[model samples]
Target: MDTALIVTVVVALTAWVFLLRSSMISMIWGPVVRSAGGDAVWAAVTSVVLYIAGLAAFALVVLAVHWALGGLPARALVLVLSALYAPVAFMPAPDRGARPYEDVRRALVRAGATEEQARACAWATGPLAFAGLAVVGGAVISVFAG
Candidate 1:
């Protein structure tokens, strides 16, 4: 199996999970944090841009490491990080955003926002669930590829 593929798969998946978590946080509290004049649309656009930038940075560093040292060490770092991430990725996503805000969101739920709407109110969004499958699929592909 090619190490580029392994690195690419793992790095991108890690990046995406991080992006999803950030996006969820934004959706959950973009309004409160920037209440006076926050644009959700713009906030989302910014998050995607940041994710792309970070992913590019990660790819460059990992690929450079692969070229300078060797593939095994580069892949090993990602593999270990993913192992540490397994508990978070495997566990159920928390019902609301991260804490402090979770309390506010809970209050919103009590104040009459619908279950789905209170937590996930947004103008536009990405398909995070299907996107998660891409990560899973990448892992499955890597397995079969070897």
Candidate 2:
């Protein structure tokens, strides 16, 4: 219903998907490929379904923010949304590994994650790192916001 909310949601969602693309695409693609014995059609269907689900969740987050905050002015709403997502969109260290931290990665390898599975878990770092940063950022903002 609100234009700014709409824009912010669309942009933030786009950024999230872009940020998640490489690894997650691999993740979704892997299963269907295996289960259907490398069926391109099944892989495509699975990918589409998963993507739509992710987008829906992003929409829900925006709606929740709107309802919880009562109605931020468009500018302010956009600012808050940016604050929430920017850290995720632009990670501080591009070269740094995304997840399973160094120790975790080693442990995963030791535990028998198959090279591919271990790599996938390592990619989990991308989302995990961003989610961690977002939570911390939100906490900092909350302290200042109040």
Candidate 3:
């Protein structure tokens, strides 16, 4: 297999793992955190749901772009889309009374996590969700480079 293809596959796998982790955290832990009276478990759950939904959306977009472009161009299109979607992983929780990340943080703190620990946890999980796109982008570039 081409190195580019390998890179692409790796990235996609990474992204999938991140998405799965996020979903699992929300589904399994969301309720526990909420029951504990953490800030806004619902909001955090909503964000996780949204994040998963966004990944689905990106997948559809990739399929559509592939269909439209065909072959190499499809890869290019995927790269562009991935690049565009990458930043969303880092989005802060909703403010204006919307508390998703904050809710999670509150729960973590209640669970004896320090502020730094909670933030670090958020940073770790949040970015993993975007790893797939990053892989796609890397794969596209690698393929095109050859």
Candidate 4:
């Protein structure tokens, strides 16, 4: 196999593993502590499986792009990936009322947060999420650029 293809596979696999591990940890620990509920072991196992499936889907998409483009254009690929994930950053804003964090906050406070507080928190988190996506995109681009 070509060095680039080998490198791509390795990078994808590493990303998949990292995501799976983190997802598993969060799923197991977060819910267990947050609500004092759910089965941590099952959560961990299920999250790992789901994350692996997500990685498979991501790999397919990347492969499709690579094939269609006839080679990786690192900058373009990074831009496309960033655009695809950009929605995630904005998603928390519109539905904060229904989100788990808001639910927890409301449970603690008699009247919950004012609309402004909720909006501020949601908007603040969006930028952090975008920064995280950018970091991931940069890592991906660097791998393929090799």
How do these models rank on TM-score, best leading? 3, 1, 2, 4
**Minimal lDDT window, size 10, model 3:** 88-97
For each candidate, the alpha-carbon lDDT, in order, equals: 0.43, 0.44, 0.52, 0.42
lDDT of 4 at 114: 37
- Model 2: CA > 4 A from native: 1-20, 27-35, 70-146
> What would you estimate as the lDDT of candidate 4?
0.42
| Candidate No. with top lDDT | 3
Q: How close is every model to the real structure, measured as TM-score?
A: 0.39, 0.34, 0.43, 0.33
3-105 in candidate 3: lDDT tens per residue?
A: 7776775577446544553444444434434453434544345445666666667767776776777787887667666555554543422223354466446
Tens-digit lDDT string for candidate 2 (23-136)? 432444344334533344553354345434544454456556545664345335645664454443322112444543443334334543344543444444334445434543
Stronger candidate by TM-score (2 vs 3)? 3
lDDT at position 114, candidate 3: 54
